[model samples]
Target: MTDLPFDPIQLMREHPEKMHIPGGLLTKQGPQDYVGGVPAITGTLFFNDAHTAEVREAICACFDEYEVIAKAHLTWLWRAEPPEGPDKFVYEKAPSMRAMIKRMNENDLVSFTYVSGKQPHDAGDWEFQVFGRRGWEAKMIVRGTSALRFTMPLLHVEKNPAAFQAMFVSFAKRLKALHGYGGQGLVLSAPRESDNQPFEAYLANMLNGLDVGEPVGATRSAHLGIKTVSWLTAVNHKMIEKIGGLSAIRSELPMDWFALYDYGAGLVVQAGPKPEGAPADQPKPARLVLPNMLFKEVRAPKVSLHYASKEGEPRLIGWGAEQWLQRFDVPEDEVQAYKARLLDEPKLTKATTLPDRL
Candidate 1:
């Protein structure tokens, strides 16, 4: 397996500076091997408020906690010169993690990307991004909100999901996240502009459970509501109130099937014991219906196009991307049918019993 092109961890460990990015890895492997074998799990949270002193501190602390478990997965950051200068996107090395965070605290709008490799843009095994649109309040129309996101190896998550969940809850508690979701997500080489998008766009269409995510667009477009539901979904107090509070949600979604955790200012709903990327081509929507109900309640404001098309290559953009985001949407006529099915399913009472497939 170490010899395989998809094994980024092995390559990174062998020659830290000479690692291949996701696009390069894809070039060396077939589409099935590339998308199916990429071992990354992503988590993102959106904040309505600015990256204030308290919020910045909490963000750094969460990163520290994650570092303890990922074991030095972050090594370098892409920082612009003159830390307090006007908006500029440059990948300069930071003097230290503490210093980099201090600079982040000073700025109103910041874009920070931390990679695991020694070099700035090396195809590291893990990555963290903090895009703050803190100064948008003064603008005529607020475009994007602040967002904090990270991607790491799935093996770490499998080994200790509790630790990761604890960290995720801490983020929601301290940051006062408006809404967020995390689970099986792709970590592209160039997240903003990557050659892997065509394949990602393909897998996104095929997998109902995979999170086809982009923090920047999500922060911008999801101002009205959540983007999508995943293994873990976090919604703040305000959002919960919109859908009739915790009591109403509990009544609609049975506790026996879904586990809900209170994180001070919000709640994190766990869909199942483990993350699943159920095939989108399947006829049955058994595993998707439960979450689909919650998704419909939240109703994502808009679904931004995740991939840009080349002159002639296969891709999902425009109408195609919008259709994929609404893949779980039940037609108005079929809504009652789905609701009836959900009501008839028995809740799992035994520890070993499978969760309700609503």
Candidate 2:
């Protein structure tokens, strides 16, 4: 594919919403305008079928012509430690897309939604569209108008290494073609089973951070997304409003994220002992996810993190704020010093002792 001239300055001036900020507000303020509204495309193809190669080719060819940009997305890998084999996954069986098509004629293996940078955003709610390779095996999934609508946290695809590799390699080859052309429309996403070692490795090299931003359909989602602002943690609008009133908050944080928390409890030292006591009361790291003011104010409370397994391989995903409390674990005998206040304290006590008092 012929390389196209893509000028940041010109594009930004023409369409400020899509350009980086340098000479204008976009440079400083960031991309406020969103423009990615091509109804996402999706289709299910059998693992080994006559049409498989054509589909791969078409997707690849189209990718070569796409406008490239960086976008963040959810990615996973499931390759086992190889003993002494070629270390290749699924592509070998149907090396050539042509072979894949032929294999399809005999028996097909269906693939779930092999999403693109563009597709995941289209299937908001972070849903995945399923597409199986063949029709005979139960693995052959039926195509739907929208996404597969599976529950959250995604399905881990560890056991099915064989099928996972086949789907991933073909999908990745297509991605590499796009990368070669600077394609940036899709956010890399996959069901756990479909992403194996080789597939994950290739993606790690191609993508730097799991957190990124790009035009998703009509809107733009910063590649690394803001987890929905958690009620227990900060990231709540009302909390900010109460803190210093709405005027003090920045126009926006790079992104917003929320964590799901449940009521739970852990050991807390009732009080420290004095000289007469043996060092004081006992305390431990409490497994509590409470709406305490202290936790919310901590800077860089990130919901998404960077990940890289080995030294040379590209970083995949990393740990975000990871403190989930189970509801069943609440202690029967613990007590709160005081319940959280939404509209400041009742003002029963004197003023100077309070921290955000006017």
Candidate 3:
């Protein structure tokens, strides 16, 4: 058996509670406890016929050498050779370990298996059983079309986020080194709690705080007046599009902020207070309300604007209300009239001026 790169047994021996199991096997299996709060780190790898043998060998060798005892549940899929017959694939689950191992050794059958170090398993269809018995558990399932998804549950990531992040980075790097893999090597974590929000949403919130330097609990509320909201929404939407959606933004910015509204006309975001020790110059939030018509119109390519700054400008500078009205194709006289009307409104005046520094 080949040696594993990491010694899971040593890690488990040192921290049994993290794994949600007693220190030794001698402890009888008492009533099972709920491990709901833990976050699970997951990813998928794609393999083809050329790398199948090597992939299987590496997984089996790692488990065999690590002293990680695994309960294997095997499956086999057989497809008829093409042409003469319809290319139908038949699936079969082995009734016993002996039968599964026998099929695996046969070499002709396309086999997949779930291996775990713990018992009383009740994983869903897409869940995989990871082998290492550490403070966490792992699961892998075969996603048809030669894709394999692996899930590793981190018992207390919220308590030791730095450690959890480090583990995920290391694991992702190792997995990417496997044969026949391509793409950027995806990895995702489930929500820490039962909230059903997509991972992308969670990621977007984090990015708002880290990348955009937004304040926590600060929001682009309706009070900012419609003009400012319209302009900021347009600019932010452009930035988000350039960055490739909210989830991609999260990768670049890992701070935490709640995105009350991320799609459709505009975004309404709120985040917790600034993290302790954040830099003093971080951008602060300004209240704004995006106009529905502007949001819709800016989606087209024809609309554009630029921020202009002048010496002693009110620390805020942007297109004037008249310029924006013109951009909306308002009549020249009407644009002037609207600008005159806005000048008398303090909130509208403040909204039109873009912050000198964002």
Candidate 4:
């Protein structure tokens, strides 16, 4: 648990033929040069417009708590056009970071990617990303409000789930988040590009619990709604009411295993002691039954995943993407029967198949 199940960056390096162009150019130097490789635990918080100041402070606090900069070799900033960009903007020093965030205007994008390693330019052991769109409603074609997203290495969460939960709650309260989900997921080497998604879809199919879609895209489509259930699912006061009161939810999700933590603005529902990912070869994920029930109650829609792929690699797009999203959905009439079957299934064990060998 101290390490990722597999090194994603290494996968790209070992299978360069499998990688797409442009975005995959960053990996041309091999896995050890770039920062990202580990599987990630991501949290995406959505809220109303104009709270960039608070979000900036929260990010700083989080970085300070984790000593993110001390371990990071590369820090990237994304900008739209001239004055803001001619090439990728790379900055050093905390003062500049704070200034960059402070000057952000309405509808302006705030993006940062930190590549962390024990030594400068060393193979990245962990990767962290921050993305938010201030007053996005006026700018985005999809009409999204505003969102703050964080991606942390899975090793960190595996080390301390409690601490991770606390950090998430802290963010939800400060951002006054409307809704969000956090758990196992893949972090792209070049997140802004579509290159890594084909690989993501392949992995997601094998590891059904992993969320493979881009967080910013989810923010646009799932405004004030649930995206998908995960280890930690947060819903605001308004959403809690729509899904039946807190008590009603609590009654359905047994208190013995499911822990509900209040974050002032909303509450986070923790499915179990830790995040769970059921590999395709393993027994059906009985663990997800309760979470899926919540997903149904919240009326979460089938999420979309990127479709672009290499010549003959595994692809999840169009109708394929639709099937992946509905994998956990149980029909209304079959809910009881489905729950019974899932609940009675055996748990994953030492013999359970793992995706590491793939």
Candidate 5:
């Protein structure tokens, strides 16, 4: 249970509040979801900025989900243990997503990191690392020696208004050209905040670097040194306007499972899955619509669409409802066949009892 007593570092599936884990963010059975789901919304902390201290200040102000448990070797690169202090981030205690959001009602944070090889060793002796301290299941682990570390306070939703929107537009067009169409819109969740950056951009800038550092400009935070977990709860419309808009978007959106959630700073969509082995642009990720993970003790979401609504807005509907769906990672043609056998029906009704999310 979210508020009920439980261990922090234990498997989340064991917790009542953490059930229905967002796709990709969790170590699920299959590929992560990308077509319109809260899993697409990612909150990041930028480590490196034009200004550094302001960035660190901004980062410390909000949620500290990362506790430096102990520095040691994980499977591949480096991993940092949670800091041994009350000031460090703790999911169950203070500095929660809600508390940090309250502290950062008007500001955001950034941090800087650098990776370098050990000076005296054979160039691979030791490496510096920065862990995103992302939620338990999925995480962001960066390694280097020295330079600028950008702690990204990023939420991966649909396309970024400015850049990603254009990329999605192009992908949508290519799909149209191929004569492919679908009922559900695209859904994407990035472990790192900037995963929202077009896949091409990532390949070009971060991976391939043909246009190295091309995306440097987009990583800059709006309020330097300012921090707020609430930024994640900011109005999606405003964030879309600042970043760009939906005019250029072309990804298919299926009406049945599609639902939109404005989680401050961004809007998230609950989308259907795409055909298997499709390109990044055409028929985006297929996903079963899942509800935003909630805390059992708190009645409202810590960062929610309603929390961002304008003052004195009309009565709300379709919010914080308790419905869940079982996602399938099968082929498009087989999805219906599989559903018929598993659910034994084409649609869900009040009688269907779903599993509780961990």
Candidate 6:
């Protein structure tokens, strides 16, 4: 698909509430101006034709009985996968397909509402009209397999997290019974603060820490990470001083460096003394420590960090090694020598002081 021009700045100027912009710069607006009337809860569930009728009935019944839902709709999605293999799933017109699906959803929702006895009182009031007509679309798209999607316009229940959780849990339970014992399902809902933007965009802004008047997302996050490490180091020094210096703490804790390795953009040092008991051949359990604060934060698809547990096998950490490296300030040249000493060289002597400063 051709890349359409997307000017976030222009969007922010026109639709201040939708984009992340400063409050001071915005017009003097009241609560009603920015109030997103009702939250839309939308998600997809995958199941075969065996449970289709029962699932649809349960969903419709749930919407009908639940007074909290102002309007709701459920539909099936037909997805087409690449015939070559499961590896390359990217379609040529993927973006266009998404845009088309969104438009079709809006149009279909309007027709569905009218047929279902929830016609809007004021057609001129675009906001109110659109609210009742917000739902997911049923369409064939290139990528993945077929699934069912449900969209619900939640009433005042959006303001209360506990109530929303309970509602979804009950809804899930009812669907689970119809889908049978081990069927897969998921519930998606936007937070109360999210102002009617695409759910993906809202989540992206949140993870990048971009809110009103805040610094531009990723850059701000990187700066804050550096500051955090500096602050923590200063605090560590002060605490050492208060407790009669590093020597005193070291005597009690007795930590020893085990191994060091260059992980992504920074270095990771395995620290802490070997665990007590067990077989001699067993590897020591040490905490993975980041030792560089200036490393560039890496955010990529399907990349993460794996760390061994104290008891069980290794577990995956969501953020990658590069992102984790942003929490320290170790020098580049010292990394190789540190690794050599910890892994190749024999133990020299035990000292009652902290590891050398970065």
Quality of model 3 by C-alpha lDDT: 0.25
lDDT digits (tens) for residues 202-274 of candidate 4: 5676777777676656666666367777777888887788768887777666554566778788788766666
Give the Cα RMSD of candidate 5: 20.6
Best by TM-score: 1
- Which 10 residues in a row give candidate 2 its minimum summed lDDT? 267-276
Models 1 onward score TM values of 0.76, 0.20, 0.25, 0.74, 0.24, 0.24
> Across residues 1-358, which tens digit of lDDT does each residue of candidate 3 receive?
1122333234333542343321111112212232221123333322223124444444344323222211232122212222122222222332432233333421233333342222222121112312211111111212111323343333332243233222222222333321111111112111111111122122222222111101110111111222222111222444345436566534322222211223222232221111111112432221111122223233322111112222222111133323332223433344344434433322422222212212
lDDT of 6 by residue, 12-56 (tens): 324422432211111123122222222133322222111134544
For model 2, residues 1-358, the per-residue Cα lDDT tens digits are 1111344324422542332211111122222232222111111111222124554454433222221210123221111222223222332131332233343442333222322223222221122332222334322322211101111111111122122222222332332211000111122233221112222222223222111211111011111122221111212233344445333332111001111211111101011010000111222112121222222332223322223333332222443113211111224333232222112222212221112212
Report the Cα RMSD per candidate: 6.8, 21.4, 22.1, 7.8, 20.6, 21.7
Backbone clash count for every predicted candidate, in the order shown: 0, 53, 14, 0, 72, 3
The top-ranked prediction according to lDDT is: 1
Quote model 1's TM-score: 0.76
- Superior candidate under lDDT, 1 versus 3: 1
lDDT of each: 0.60, 0.22, 0.25, 0.57, 0.22, 0.24
- Give the runs in model 6 whose Cα sits over 4 Å from its true position: 1-44, 66-68, 71-155, 177-358
| Residue 143 shift from truth in candidate 2, angstroms | 32
Model 6, C-alpha of 19: deviation from truth (Å)? 7.7
lDDT-superior candidate, 3 or 4: 4
When 1 and 3 are scored with TM-score, the better candidate is 1
Candidate 5 structure quality by residue, lDDT tens digits, 92-142: 232332243234312232111211112111111111222222222111112
How would you order the candidates by lDDT, starting with the best?
1, 4, 3, 6, 2, 5
